[model samples]
Target: MAQTDTPGEHASVLRLPGIVLGVGLGGFADGILLHQLLQWHHMLTSTDQDRIGVKYYDPDTVPGLRMNTVWDGIFHTVCWLAVLTGLAILYARVTQDRRRVWTSRVLWGWMLVGWGLFNLVEGVLDHHVLGIHHVYAGDGQLWWDLAFLLMGALLVGGALLLQRGGRPLALPAGAPGPDAR
Candidate 1:
């Protein structure tokens, strides 16, 4: 990345806040689209025990639906916290740096990278390592999980392409500060 003489310009180009926001937003997308909209799977729909084998929750049942709803709420809470934290970091970065560019290619690229990271991490940890839940909480779970990772990889690759050749947009003169925005 090119750097200006001023330290704030360089700092503004870091794009860490954008990345964080992307990750958190990506998580929200997953939770909202996949979990709620499509009704694919819940947080704890597919459960496996050491000796008791595997069990699947019936969404039709009141108790089962309640359990799934609770878990889903927990998942939503985590995603919400991530977004709020990311917004806080972004506010700090933008306000602290005078020359911070709000609409930079690097920032958008990094945000895409963050979303990719969210997908990769969540897919690996939740779907494989922890085996708590998956994209499709039933047989052939591995294929669906692998597909999620592949999509994440695509997002990262796309971000790299976007970041390759673009100049950062300067913040508008006389623009209201982050407090107003």
Candidate 2:
């Protein structure tokens, strides 16, 4: 039988929609709060330190800041696309009882899982692997970066625990939704 033939067997996979949503939302939070409001860091802010020799775009200079702003816009666009895609997937997967699904621990857990994954991947790849930027990129920057990773770990672990108590969602287990594939 194909994967869609057994919803029960793939019940956990339903988290995909929530995860995608979380990735976008979490990214928005990061960009809005950190990049805009806090002025903490911008895209390519630390490219001067990049391991791969990316041209640095210093946020302190007009030309540099312009470049960083453009890159930030690109980042936000990607996040926006992720959110749109996530919503489309969610609409297809949950054909009924969306209110309950929205309130369910499972959905929230999956969302947290997505957020955590974002932090983990971004923190590691951007902060550590890519040498792009630190969380604060100043005194005690490593501490902030480490803290970010720690928060991600905690979120993922806590979300998994929370999801354990959730009842299985009332999706059409036998009947595939539009996203059955």
Which of the numbered candidates is closest to the native, going by highest lDDT?
A: 2
lDDT of 1 at 145: 94
Candidate 2 structure quality by residue, lDDT tens digits, 58-121: 8999999899899889999989998898888887877665566676677777788888888899
Off by over 4 Å in 2: 1-13, 169-181
Per-residue error for 55 in candidate 2, Å, reads: 0.6
TM-score of each: 0.76, 0.87
lDDT of 1: 0.70
- List, residue by residue over 93-123, the lDDT tens digit for candidate 1: 5654434445455666767888999999999
